[model samples]
Target: MRHALILLSISATSLFLMSATPLQSQTEDAQSIRMNQVGYFPNGPKRAIFSSIHKSDTQKHFRLIDATGKKEVFRGILTKPEYWKSADEWAAIADFSQFTQAGLYVIEVQGGVLSAPFQIHNHIYEYALNASVRTFYYQRASISLDANHAGPFSRKAGHLNKSIPYHKDLGKAQNARTASPGGWYDAGDFGKYIVNAGVTTSLLLMTHERFGSIFPDGSLNLPESGNGTSDLLDEIRYELEWFKTMQDADGGVFFKVTPLKFAGKVMPADDPSLQHMIGKSTSSTLNFAAVMAYAARLYGDVDQSFAQQCLQQAEAAWQWALKNTSIRYTQGTKSSNYKDVQTGGYGDQHFEDEFLWAKTALFLATKDSKYSISIDDLPEKYSAPTWAQVSALALYSIILNEESFAKKVSEKAKVMVQQASVKILKEVMAHPYRINQMNYIWGSNIVPLNAILTLSFANHIEAHPVYLTTSVELMDYTFGKNPTGYSFVTGFGTKSPLHPHHRIMMADGIEPPIPGFLVGGPNRGRQDANSLKRYGGYPSQAPAKSYRDHTASYASNEVAINWNASLVIALSFLEHQRALSIHEPK
Candidate 1:
């Protein structure tokens, strides 16, 4: 008994000593700064490179070096370091706007660290825009790619569900063929979802509406390029055609067409699985109506016949929504299980938002006072709109068309804009990240990007410099001002994710992930066990620190179509605004 007590005492003392030992030194890593690898200057807005340096190392200076010869192009001291309490470090800013001479340059920091090589030229972002927009082409389903069209990323066709037969319940035989094929895959998967497509298509259409004159006919290099219409509209029309196929004879829109189960990690051409054109709900029908109406007006001058078809379909869907208003997506036992637990369900319990969205689009398409009556009671503030919650779309349409409406409607629209702008500005000032979210959930990167969009809208209405400045600050956070210090984009920055959760890039044995794809940033949901397994026992619980670069970390690193749509819109706006600024007299 005495020997046992002596052993226990010794073990306790050893445990105490182990607990008292200090952790390893928390030195700042060299890969902590991120900036656009392909930069711009002279005719563009000022570029700011970001770093998270230790508080003790705040006085360090950085130099821009000529990449070809290792000669120093310029040296500049970093701006006063700002401490981020969430990250427990000081954020550093390095501005290279003064280096306007055309050259290939790399930013060099202390201890011989270097950023990715970048160029100072007028057309730098033009290349980025092309790459970003063409990424959608690579994600096209029911289509074949050749070397001429997709370059080295060519592959065979996938999911040619052209002969999609109606379900037996629709009074048509399930085995009979009905033509329905062609749309961009929703994400890393080869699925086509209506709710996700609605938001993505809206953003793309808005892009064309704003920059139609700027982009040339063949800029995107699609198969339909130089076809007497802008390539941007051509790309959108491809998806819009597929969207038409999703609507039933009853004018109801199906939620999605997906495999019965999630596919393995394989190329789109390799995934030879049966596709199920699944269930429809009120939200999906209303979303379909909203997108169709908006597209009808945009395509009016370009293709009159197609525009008229879109308007007819939009009216039909709106009528269907009016009759069956309260239906939500429930996994009915009838037919095959399209419950969609595997992919995104896109279920929205709030039917009012979709109703309002469809109403606004219909109002814009036709000068109908009936749609205007529904706009009296608007939401107090806008919460960075998404597929699930899209009231902001209605708000935007109303604000844009205020002048065209009578006093009763226009006055309400103006008041909603002012209230929303004040709310957004207040939130932007309060947050340390300079964005408006309280927590970082799944697809958190979209939060800041959406805020940038709202700010741009407000700036358009009032033309305040503060709105633009705040927008740029949010852009800085996205590029790399916060924790993780990694660019959210796959290939634009000094340090970016090489192993994105993209199946094509993974199966192709590529050296780097596809360019211009924006990975979902820092999702603290941490729900996937696959992600947790690859966390190396160091998963961060904090909202800003929850991101990892591993391919298995899909929660933090998966790229999605809707997220990229937001990015394309934001970046295109910047490029367009900058182009105008360049020609302005000083």
Candidate 2:
């Protein structure tokens, strides 16, 4: 693959730290600095800042030190202190974009604060992107990961279902195991869920749609790299193939395929539990409908027959959803034999979001008037595209599409985009870390990530520098610069989370968790039992201060397919922007 050379060169010499290095003990006046561990591209937008917990004015200069941690690489002057009224803290900004030399460097504050070393290069994030995408490959089930094909992460085939049994509601089960072979594990658990797949697949497709030039054929170094399609599309199709098998003859899709109980901490091949295909809810069916419809369009040029099949399945699911609109896949009632509280339920009471999303996809795919009416009628206020909330996704697809839309639908999209942009800007200004209250729930890191999508859409509608800057601040808070003083992404920063709640990382004896796996960031809710048992005693209820880096802190430490998909979208957007900068006339 074209990107492999760049990735290998950087990662070949990288050290896999077994644990996080402790931050230097803070003096009363010490200032804490934070930035992404991989640093910025030499020609890209670059900014980092120092946080002062005391809210005291830090009238000090900072320096960038070379790899030796002794030689000064660049000197930096501090900007005027900005008071954050919400957290009662002060932050000072630093911009060293003028220092364009490609090398490893660390930020050093005057009073004993030293940042983790980072690099500035043309392809610094190529490796991060590769590692992030490879996680999906690592999660592929029912396929033998040959050493020659999978490299160091090779494994035997798992979950090879020769036949599948339909739930009692659907019909009698198939006697022979139907092959639902390859798709990602939804999260830490070994479940393949359609609801989560809907968001994850769309984000990956968005990368190809928006940044197709970046990923040439053979760019991702996957086993299918040499295939006619782009590596990104190939990886997405690998999962889509499995998704095709998830639909019943009736056209409705199952919620997930998983064991009767959550598997223990074990390797994919070693988890010897029988997999069950369960749940046929409107939410899952509509989500399946949306993804399949959009994917049909994506696959049209590559494989027309498969594209037609996807559209057919999508239309089928849409029809099934209309007949059974109100059925929610409650955890315990979805399956008769297994009332799963152990695995992800992905259940939602509201179907309007799913309805609008499926309608948008159908409208775009076929230009059907029936679908357009519903698209125009979609509620103005809807949740961002979370696992349970996906109305924003429909808006994104509508806004990004070049096809003509009804005046009502177009006006609705613009209104939604502007309202979301304003909400994010207002909240970011109110908070010290620039993260909003919307991100204070479980898997909070994804909120800012989802906002980036919204901001990107808003940027497309009208070029707003504040929207882009706010997006950057969101990146800073996510990568580092938060109250926890740790980079939420594993294997990137000096002070990154080492113990994420990922089963393979925990049980596989990996030194650090998988590179580029973004941990669920600060969550004040602390809803998971694991998190409550470990960190609930902490007195601080401030949103940013509620995170812990332990593997048991599922609320704040678990990694998910949908979250990483969001990261991929953000990273690809930055990469695209960096490309634009590089090509600009001097």
Candidate 3:
């Protein structure tokens, strides 16, 4: 592959201790500093957010204090605080990128404010990257988890899904059953949805394909950790195998395996809701075709027989999508929480992107123009990939595997990625937090990461250093560098989300939520109850500040595989960039 990146071997990363939620000892000081809570890289960019300081015009200074707070190894002047409209807060930035030493340290402001400790190292993000990837293992549906692998989060497998019946719309007998099993739960709920899985699964597979060295075998501590195969692939194969069952005899893929409504906050084994096929759509079928083709190419060497099977499945799905091209995911059962909207409905009426993606992926797998889309057929605009809109996924596939694509198609793909990258780069530069706008809707956290992913792809399309540097800043925004000043990830920071809106963490009797899961961050819309049950009101109505750390605040603090997949790949790509900066010495 022409786009094959230089492989970087990884060392074992040290464990990050789980700090007490809202660390009582440093609660007041913690608010004074905002940065990547995990740490900064020794040679990478180092910046932090400082607020509510400055005794005199000339005294706006911050010091890098050792973990003991007794020694000041470095000092830097704070930039003037800039007013950010979204959160209506003044934030000052301190740049200390010149400090290339590796150590644990904190920041000290003028008014006796201090930050929680963080590290500076070459492999600063390796552990978080591994954790983000391992979160998939925790989400596996079917089979029990042993303590050796799952540790404190071990649980008996639920959602056996051996005999899920089809809904009446499928025109099957009332007693007919199809067994679809062994994929991660889609979100905080117990639904196994294909429409959402389309973007999530493909991204994971792409990450593994591009950066295979970072996720070496046994790195993720999966059940198949040491099976002499990439643990990430082992995990992805489980989902792919489940995807195999999702395809009907005629090749259409079912939209989701879900009950009429979502389950309550109960353990997976105890969720009483019935699991069955909701429906199928053109979008889902095309998505299935694209991923199957992608899997066939990536897994060809790992499992020749399985790769051939996937290629066949991809062909069948392409034929099905050709016939059923306009099917939207309009059929959804009733849910108590949702009234008119389709519960768990990945409402997408647009199938052009889906069509292009399926064609591009099949082309990559087969190198056949019959399965390829012409550059003239592309949409005029390109956007960052979401489950609903994945035109970029197709373009990215063409861009990454340029050798397998026609020069015109490859150039067009690069132009599309760069077009989207320009918009995101402009926004990243304009925002005070070094992000795009606070798209603080449901799953708003993934917005910046989607930008990060696009920027990375654009970097691949045209190797510009600024593309990747901007991408890292967006990643920093997700961790703890944003207006919220909270690491949205469940367990990697000094003050992380303690109670994400995940049913398993709530019902599993665990005092701490599992590590590596990125919670849905702040949403301006307080659509969920303000003070539901044990949860309190959101801190503020400000779009950037409207977040609660309560399990009941599903509007803001929820976990989903789709969102986590973005986080995993962003971390992996950033780590790859860091590795290149080290080993390549360019």
Best by TM-score: 3
Query: In candidate 3, what are the lDDT values of residues 346-427, reduced to their tens digit?
Result: 8888899898888888988998868767777666788778898888888888778888777887888788878888988788
- Sorting all predicted structures by lDDT, with the top scorer first, yields 3, 2, 1
Tens digit per residue, CA lDDT, model 1, 1-586: 2222322433343243223222211234445555544455454334443445655666678888776677887888776666655454556667665666776666777666665555566655554566577778888888887766676667888788876645443345647656668989888777788988888888888888876765667766678887889888888889999999988889888878877566778887788666777677898899899999999999998999999899889989999999999877655444244433355677688877788888888878987777664445565555556898877777777766677666666556556665666776788666544556546788888877887788777866787656655565566556654577676776555556788877787787667676678888886677664645745832466667778787677788888889988988877766676554342112
Lowest-sum lDDT 10-residue window in model 2: 16-25
**What would the TM-scores of all predictions be?**
0.84, 0.87, 0.92
List residue ranges in candidate 1 displaced over 4 A.
1-28, 40-88, 94-121, 164-178, 332-341, 411-438, 529-541, 582-586
Worst 10-residue lDDT window for candidate 1 reads 17-26
Over 4 Å off, model 2: 1-7, 10-31, 41-45, 64-103, 164-179, 333-341, 436-438, 528-542, 582-586
Question: lDDT of each prediction vs. the true structure?
Answer: 0.71, 0.73, 0.80
Q: Which of candidates 2 and 3 reaches a greater TM-score?
A: 3
Model 2 agreement with the true structure over 1-586: per-residue lDDT tens digits: 3434534543452442212223333443322666665666675445676775344555578887765446787887777677654333567776676777777766777765777666677776666666677677777877887655455456777677655554454455455344566788888888899999998998888778877676766776678877788888888988899889888788888888877678888887788787877777898899889988988988899999999999999999999999998987766655564455456787689888888888888888888878874344667684677778888788777777735586667778877888888898898766645566554778878888888777878878887666665676577666666666676776665578888888777787767566778888777777665545645443346766677777677777889989999988887776666554432112
**Which runs of model 3 end up more than 4 angstroms from their true locations?**
1-25, 53-59, 332-342, 530-534, 582-586
